[model samples]
Target: MTHFRNDMENHDFFDTNIVCSIVIYEWANELSIIDFKHIFDWISQLVGTAPDSIQLAESEAKYKSYKWKYFEKNNVINRREWDLIAYHWFRNIETKSGIRVYCVASTRSFRRLGIYIDEAAVVDVIGVMKQISRTIIEKVEPIYGYGAMQSYLDGPLEYARGINVTTYYSHENIFSQADVDTRERISAFGSEFRKNKRRLNEKLRDVEVINYISAGHLAGIVDGMTLEDWIISGNRGTLNKEGEATWVWRIPDEHERSQIRTDLIRSGLLVVTI
Candidate 1:
């Protein structure tokens, strides 16, 4: 067997998800918890049998355990280190062509989670693989309710156009109409008010200044705008439009480009030539 000492020293760590995907793709037939344990145990045994490999694995494992324990105590593990170790382990296995062993274990659940391997560790790997385990879960859980709020808005918007024609459309006059005509007028006015409010909000929302710079000018503008927005506005050079060179703004009608230019000039980020 290829030795762990030689392999570990040379490998570059990769993301756990990639390793899991590779294993699943390659060993869809016989992957299991038991199989995973067998492979790890076999590797561990090789470490034991080879003095150099054993020393390396022990040294690496000691350092890893110390780092893990430190992070665990201080809560830094959730922020960064765990993923790094899993990444290292995954890279070490795949770099040495040991992916077939993981592939075999991925097919068998029992073998995959068996004794020599901790199911919690595999759970950790699964969590890392999905990019949605402890670290993400902790960060996302607090914001989970926002998703429901979004769904509530999105659900209405999905059928908003057809809502008036639907039977479920609740009009005040439809239920109680002692003064049918007056109620109809009031309801129409209320609907108009709501529609106008929505439109006004949308218009207000649409008004935002967008700035752009070419790749060559990126370093100068990085602090002023997002990388994504910069990329969306393609690279272009400013030409001397008249006696002076001018940068053009390309925002849709809602935004006032002159105001943006004034602000940029006032901030001294942009210079206007006479």
Candidate 2:
């Protein structure tokens, strides 16, 4: 692992231990159409909310229907108005006493950018996409750290695992396990397989080679291989025909360029450049 100095300025960070609720509102809008009933049913099962017990106020229902029709007629809504409403709702719940609430949704409608939801609530307004056939409650569980009280509306929101660069790899591991099981359990869950494959490919692309050695040895082996001032300048034929220079990367000849390249391949690192 590579370590870097901390260069962050002091700032107020949110409490990571607090219990938070997440609400994913799929409200009908001018941009995208979704199946409200299906989403409601899926969330209900996840949250342990009785399907029949969830209340849909009459006025809210009417407004939803009107907005649905309006969206159908017009391609999109007034962006400013929609943003204002979303902001107001988030502010209303975020400042509530005793508990922290987070608004998370895939849709860009929500104004809280890059804020991970402590809880997700799918409002009755947003309809579900038609292509979705099954709900994967387990996938959502690990996203919020496992053992969170899973619920649709009004369920106790459990804190999700803090998402950092290191945890990103962990998340991929969990997702890979889920994909393997999903392929065995459901015949049509090929989507999960494709998604995992794509992620694996992306991770392979980020692999890099780091060379650490004594400043003196690196200078003797190759120019510009060590710290700037420590580098030796001379006609050293350290580069290959492709103009790719070789650096003394602290590995013995047995683990040098050719051998290391092979090792990296086995370790799932695609060497795009020497």
Candidate 3:
């Protein structure tokens, strides 16, 4: 399979592929506790209500709801330092014409922000938030001192994703086109990535393929064996053994098995082979 390969010269074969992406960020703006308080107060004042009191009003023809709350839990802001949050709210605005702007404060970086355009919206939420955050930061940046504004997809490391916006600093999708067979194999592997590892002692006399999921867990068979030997042997067979497993991954050869195993091991998503 494409994911598994043999290096002829090295006479080696490895299974699977794991990909990781990370971005780091530095301080862009600064804000003190008092400044954050003021910002929250300003936003609440603009809407003519207290943070918790913000909600849709029947009087306004347009649908609207603005809410916020403060928490003193341990959190990483700006630089990996723990600090309390002053203002936080997930906001969605839609015009009568169907234009929408969705925005949320960066939970990672207390002072950072994020905006993603809704699929149906005509206007870019990023463009709108950029202008609004710029003004807010301009007024608060010098006063409060916070990290720079970095845009990131919805996930962890939004702060790291914010470190810089240049192509070099931004997240890049490295996925490439795979042939039909390769695509199918990858699809199968990904779908079952969280399944427990299957036991095929026949392929690995001493070692047993294992499952991995999130953060850690990937050592390839109980005992380390030469890639060549592992390839020559395999773990696939006719459906003979059965119990609670809903399904099993019918590995073709140890070479391909090792590749898939390697990929799963690297990404930390191997489930018991099933």
Most accurate candidate by lDDT: 3
Q: Which stretches of candidate 3 lie over 4 Å from their true place?
A: 1-30, 43-82, 90-127, 140-274
- Taking the tens digit of each residue's C-alpha lDDT, what string does model 3 give over 111-183? 3332222222222323433343444534432111112221222221222121211222212443333345433
Task: Give each model's whole-structure lDDT.
Answer: 0.24, 0.24, 0.28
Q: Write the per-residue lDDT of candidate 2 for residues 1-274, one digit (tens) a residue.
A: 1111122111212222222222222111222212333343344343333221111122212222123334335533332222211110121223422122222223232211111122222221112211111131211211111112222221232112111111112211331122332223222212332233322212121111222122222233212232223222322213211101212222223334345444344543321222
**Order of models, best TM-score first:** 3, 2, 1
Each model's TM-score? 0.16, 0.21, 0.24
Model 2 lDDT at residue 221: 20
Candidate 2: which stretches are off by over 4 Å? Answer: 1-14, 18-41, 44-103, 107-134, 137-274
Instruction: Give per-residue lDDT, candidate 1, residue 202.
Output: 13
Q: Candidate 1, 5: how far from true, in Å?
A: 2.7
State in Å the error of residue 184, model 2. 37
